[model samples]
Target: MSRALFRSSLPELGSFSAARLRPTAAVLPFSWTTTTTRSFNSTAPIVEPVSSNNAPNPTASQVRPLALKKSHPAAPPSPIADSVKNLLPFLAAQPGHYITVHIHGFPYLVQEGDQIRLPFRMPGVLPGDVLRLNRASVIGSRDYTMKGSPHIDERVFECRATVLGVESEPLRIKIKKKRRQRRKRQAKSKHRYTILRVSELNIKNLEEAAAE
Candidate 1:
C-alpha cells in the first residue's frame, strides 16, 4: 500500500514540472536584446540633415555700410541782397570819403556826418540809437564808387547809422464843420521828425572780411 501512494505522487510532480517549462519557454532573450538596442539608438546624438550638394560661405565686403549709402540736399540765397550787393562793389573801389546812402522807397539820400530829419517820428528809440540800415536801393561813392544797377547783393555792405534826436514841425490847423448844426471845431496838429546822423557806412573788402 505505501508503494502505490508513492507512484501516484510521482505523476503529479511530473505534470507540475511541464507547466513550469512552458512559462520559461514564453520569455525570449531576443525581446530584451531588441529593447536595449532601441533605447541606446534613441539616446544617441542626431547629425544635421545635409543637401546632396555643398555651397561656399559669404564675405563681409559684399555688405555695404549704411552711412556710405545715405544722401543730402542744398540751400537758398539771402533777402538782404538789395542793400549789400551794390554797396560792396562801390566800397571795394573807394578808399576814403563819405557815401550817400538812399533807402528804398525814400526820396532823401544820406551821407556820413550828415544829419537826416525824417518826415515822421521814429518810434521805440531814444537819443544816440545805433541803427543798422539794412534796406537800401542806392549807395553812391565820391568819384567812382560802384553804384547798384537797381538792387545789390545784401551780403556786401556793413552800413550803420546813429539816431540823434527828434525835431518838430510848425503847427497845422484843420477846421471841422457839421452839415446841419452851426458848430465848428479847429484841430491843431504838429508832427515830430526823427533826426539821424550817419555814423559809419563801411564796406569790408572780400579778402579782408574773409581772412578775419
Candidate 2:
C-alpha cells in the first residue's frame, strides 16, 4: 500500500513543476516597429550665397577729395618806420636791454636772467622747459626805445623763457558769520602760480624779419 501511494504522488508533482517553468506570451503585451524616411517641404525659403569679390575695397572707400580752404591775411606793416630805423641802430649799440613781454595779455617788464612769478599757472610745462615768447609791447635799451602800436611784430624780436617750477601763495582764511545766529564758517584758499626766467632776448635785424 505504501509503494503504490508514493508512485501515484510522483506524476502529480512533476506536472505542477513543469507548469511554473513554462514560457508565456502574456509577458509581452505590445510590440513596436520603426521606419526611416527623408522629409521634403516645397514652402521652405532658399538662401543665396554672398560673393565677397563684389564688395568694395577698404582703400577705395577711403579716397575722398580735399576741399580748398582760405587762409587769414598777414599782419599790417609796422607803424613806426622812421623811429624804428634810428632806434634799431642805437639799440644795437647799447650794452644792456629790457623787454616788456605780454603773456596772456599782461605785460611783464623783464630783462635776461630775471625770475618772474606769473599771475596764472602754466599747463603742460615742467621745470627746464624752454618757451618762446612772441608778443611784446616794448624792446629798449637805456637811451633808445622801440614800441608797438599794440604789439611789436614777433618776428622783430626773439624772447625765450625757462620754466623754473611752481610757486604757491600762503593759505588765506576768511570767516563768515550769520546775521541772526552765532554760527560762523571759515573759507580757506591756496593759489598756485608758475615761475619762469627770461633766458634770452635778442632784437632781429630788418632783413631777418622781412625774410620770415
Candidate lDDT (C-alpha), each = 0.67, 0.81
TM-score for candidate 1: 0.48
Candidate 2 — which pairs collide? none
Best by lDDT: 2
How does model 1 fare in lDDT?
Answer: 0.67
Whole-structure CA lDDT of model 2: 0.81
Candidate 1 residues lying further than 4 Å off, grouped into runs, are 1-104, 178-181, 208-212
> Best candidate, TM-score-wise?
2
Error of 1 at 173 (Å): 2.8
lDDT digits (tens) for residues 52-79 of candidate 1? 3333332343433333432323245554
